[model samples]
Target: MAKIEPGNGLTSAVSRNILRGTTESLALTDGEGNSFGSDSELNAYTSERQTDKYGFIGGAQQYSEQSAENIPPEVLRQREAKWLDMLNNWDKWMAKRHKKMKLRCQKGIPPSLRGRAWLYLSGGKVKREQHKGKFEELDSQAGDPKWVDVIERDLHRQFPFHEMFVAREGHGQQDLYRVLKAYTLHRPEEGYCQAQAPIAAVLLMHMPAEDAFWGLVQICEKYLPGYYSAGLEAIQLDGEILFALLKRVSPLAHRHLKKHNMDPILYMTEWFMCAFSRTLPWASVLRVWDMFFCEGVKIIFRVGLVLLKCMLGSQDKLKTCQGQYETMELLKTIDTRYMQEGFLVREILELPVSERDIEKEHLASVRRWKETRGELHCKALPRMHGAKAIMAAEPPSRQDLRQNPTIIVELPLATKSNGEDKERKKTKEEKNGKKNSSPTPVVADLEPSKPPPPLKDTALLGSNQSLSSTEHDTYL
Candidate 1:
């Protein structure tokens, strides 16, 4: 387990001073012509210190941290696999194992055992019949070449620091492009999506291209159902549910947030969407990936909710909306105590029934909302507003106020105005039943005679180099 220290933000002197409300100051020279240090022999004449561990003060210690990467590759990595086996059987082993799967994964399955594991655990063994002979058929089509352009758009930006993805016109980059391009050709409906990046990066360490491509296909189709959809609306809804759980469990933090106008999007969004890849330790992250292969998307929600419980107070509410998109920025510095609790895994497995019960609640809430809509005369509210009106609108058999969540979650005095006050602005216009701002110029704008241009996805992978870029651009 990698150790992490807590204390939010940069932790430098400048940040500490700002937190202390101190004015910035700097002094130059001995203006009074006196030495602050003693002139005694030892104090005046010692040599500069040299130590390996210290960092951040710009001496030998600082130099070492910046240069740690310069250590021989053998140091950061063990050399046991120098001329290792060239195939993988991990997936087969993993599928049959009952325990310590996370342990076996980190010891680095040798190359000989790597490819098969990548394929089998990928759920690709079952897909062999479905995709085995398809690449050649795909290449025979005119559009086969076009998928390369799309593949290129995502790969270089996926894990740009890795040798396999260094944004170069080289063998590794070309091999990645070929596999993704072939996969896209093989499954046009699921042509591509951002989910494949970390998956591909992990596989490239062990498996060859062809096998890895099939595994990627299996992961998307079998494990993540809404894998390639635009805007990821399905995943976003899961986020809303996760946020609701966080509020219920950590209400004080939740209330503190409402006081500060923070949305859960400020921290929990990426933790759910990306499964804490950037929030937890890298090895811990691999543990998640392994379980993800075994259980599917439900584990993502479960593991994410568990991580949110683990990282309780570090979540800040004041960050801007754009800042909420990734977890790494906030998580890299969260105190280890957040994840250090010894009871985490058991607690997760034993999580409160209410926390993980969203599936049942979602449908019930939907039906109740629809029932309320049918009985509009009870109250005038939006399609999904007011638990009471919704309950009243439902069938007579379901009309008890005790069965309704609005009464349970809120007092009976609740009307729309009070229930939403903590969550929304109590604006003068909203109170007066008028629009807050002037209406947009609803001028007679003619619809275009021809259809508009096809929508393009510009969320090309890892580079925040620019948030949006099209099919042809490259960071290089």
Candidate 2:
């Protein structure tokens, strides 16, 4: 007989029986009739005593597995097989089947394959390989204190309900910190932005630390340059572009919004800033990201138009809102029934918008914004080219950042009095001689002596606070 050491105060026979999968009931005490504690107490103590050795400190369930379980097994298998083939011959597949790749992305990438797929789709793998050991270097160094506190403050607020981020020092949150901090270090000028937190958190859920970091870089530099910078010039410009597109796509909603003195930044900031992560349902957010990485920032505009149409399209629905604040409240707290992942995705896919349409509107919006602000030169903040050297050294396919010429425009100051504001705006439009023919341009009554300060708080649009997560979930 082998000598057995005491384990959790269990006797050799009891331990053996339990290990052998026998469920015989045993007394709580020794033969002396003393109490060893009740079964429930023992179980509670054992459960409480358990610690995660690997430091993940969360549920064992994989996000990919949970997301994939809804699909039919055969469908999942086929998708997995296709994904495997793409992975095996990535270069060839990307060259010949690029359109096919986009089509498949529109259908939604399989959750099981999403991790690797995002890596390939974002070209994160190539960037990661080229800049090997760069993340470790950045991670080892301390991040600037300017961004560290801000990053820490927002860490727990992101995905608090999710298992991966529930624990304060869990692997997920830690990786998120490293990635965001690394970016701050990577581009000291841009520092950090609150919107980047949820974006990085989402990425961390899908891939490892380094890959997630590079993916974030791709998004910030290529897909959304100047967005996370101190001045937020890109998002400001894009907001104007979104408003322009909205006017064309849904004239009623646009007119109603304009009539009430609502600005695009009022409701659209969160929509564009976080790439719809904080606003949309989790499942829908994932699908949107799948297409977004492959298609770039154009997906964001399409989805925003669809959302606005869904929320404020009908005259009856628009009638319910009394004022700008009420209209904004209605827009922010859209009902989930209308935002079902599959239904919403189908609507987004069916929309007749294209990148060229967005680009054309973007240029026009930039021109209008600059003209309204009475500046001929671009006054927006410059792009951070810190990673340009590394990106330039990589092959064309591996180059993560696309150097689109920055189209800069000034953000107009919010008007104060409704009556005076509308009169001034109308006068400006009439002076421009395109009031009725074109979408009402967002223009300021007075251009400030100096540019406004960099936006530090969540209130990117103006003094009004951005919608909280709870506010976002509430139905109007």
Candidate 3:
């Protein structure tokens, strides 16, 4: 349970600033006052920081000082084998035995297959195939200046302590910018949201930019709609729902929050908006995301409740929180013991909050909101939960299934020359007792000897990397 402090100033500062407004003063500069963008900058900065397995700077401990659970290699092998079969027959599994898929995801997606698993789980793969080359088309076009500037300022802020984002304008930052910028272009009305950067950065960690872009799209449009929109109405609704559920799960904690006038927004904005990427340890974050993508927002709600229960559920825990400041401090500095990935996940699963419960709360919250704030402005579309639901809702077509079609070239038939044919006829006649056939010189046997043309993978021609090489990706 290697619990690093959730807020090292990077996630919280950037999240708050982006929520309000972007400013020029927020740009991070190097020792010489030069803004970071070069590979040289990344090389120099990494020398000063120790990265963890997930590549977060200053997050690792020496082997002698470390005390973390290690998944046995045999267990990992078993899980990887199961994941490989699921990935190979994803459609069949999604169509038939999606319960098995859910169980596996709950257990934890293998690190190597996590990217592909996320793509499949989120339905991003189908969406990507359906809209082939759209990301590239959008990436090629000039991004909106307002969004571009804001995106650039916020780029370095996401996972700044992580190896992926440690360098200014490094490959990680560059991909994050493209994903966010292309998203702004894709949905100009929605524009850019700072919360999206960390989510996209997480996706990029598993997959490439184009896959990550679609993953972001699914998050915004399908999984958690209106969350990053103008008013963040969806998240507000979810927050209310969370508070409402807390009242049932832990009345003591709920009463404490009520007494302090602590709204869910005060703490859960980063937790829900970033999908707990900022709040949990690296392994815990990945585990949460694995379930989040598969099961949708309920996992989020469950995680929040678990935290509240652990923090202020009982009398002993609640006694220390005498006031608002105290309670908030307790929350901000979440005890590492509660954050252990295995324990946290087990608590989340056993919490017993279901989609029906969330929906019932949602309806109640909606009625309350309508009474208080009048008619809702930003209405989110009804979305399906879990991979199976998404699969059933938007079943991949044959075209979508054939994302990478193989090309097979048929070889030309060999043919004998005229001279060779004559020699063969004379030899046949001599064998039939016609001895007058002189030894006729045989022409060399001719065959179409050239090998079949090299197979061409058309999909690679328009891939994300081919659209824009890293060398040409200049930072602003």
Which window of ten consecutive residues has the lowest lDDT sum in model 2? 17-26
Q: In what order do the candidates fall by TM-score, top score first?
A: 3, 2, 1
Give the 10-residue window scoring lowest on summed lDDT in candidate 3. Answer: 467-476
lDDT of predicted model 2? 0.64
Superior candidate under lDDT, 1 versus 2: 2
Per-residue lDDT of model 2, residues 249-275, tens digit only: 899888888899776766776678778
lDDT of 1 by residue, 1-476 (tens): 00011432112332221112101001111344211222232122222323222111111112322222233545323322321111122323333542444334333332333444444445454354344566555534555545565555545443332333433443445556656666666666546554455566555444545556666665555554443443343343455565566576666444544565444444444454445543444434444555455444544565555655554433453242223223334433454433422333344445563323665544544455457543211221122111112222332221211110111111232345565663454475578786544432332211223322333556434322221111111110
**Predicted candidate 3 versus true structure: per-residue lDDT over 1-476, tens digit per residue:** 01112532123433452353212113444554334556667567667756566766543211112223577878876787787677667788877888878998998887866877888899898998889799989989889998898888777666656666666656777788889999999988788877888899898877778888999999888888888776666777888999999999999999999998887877787788888877777778888999999998899899999999999999999889899879877987788778778789999999989989998998998999889878776777675676777778888876665433122234342354789887787687778877654444432221123322433444332112322322111100
The list of candidate 1 runs beyond 4 A from truth reads 1-115, 139-150, 247-249, 253-275, 278-280, 314-358, 361-476
Pitting candidate 1 against candidate 2, the one with the higher TM-score is 2
Which regions of candidate 2 deviate over 4 angstroms?
1-69, 374-476
Cα lDDT of candidate 3 equals 0.73
**Candidate 1 residue-wise lDDT at 302:** 58
TM-score between model 2 and native: 0.67
Residue-level error in angstroms, candidate 2, position 272: 0.9
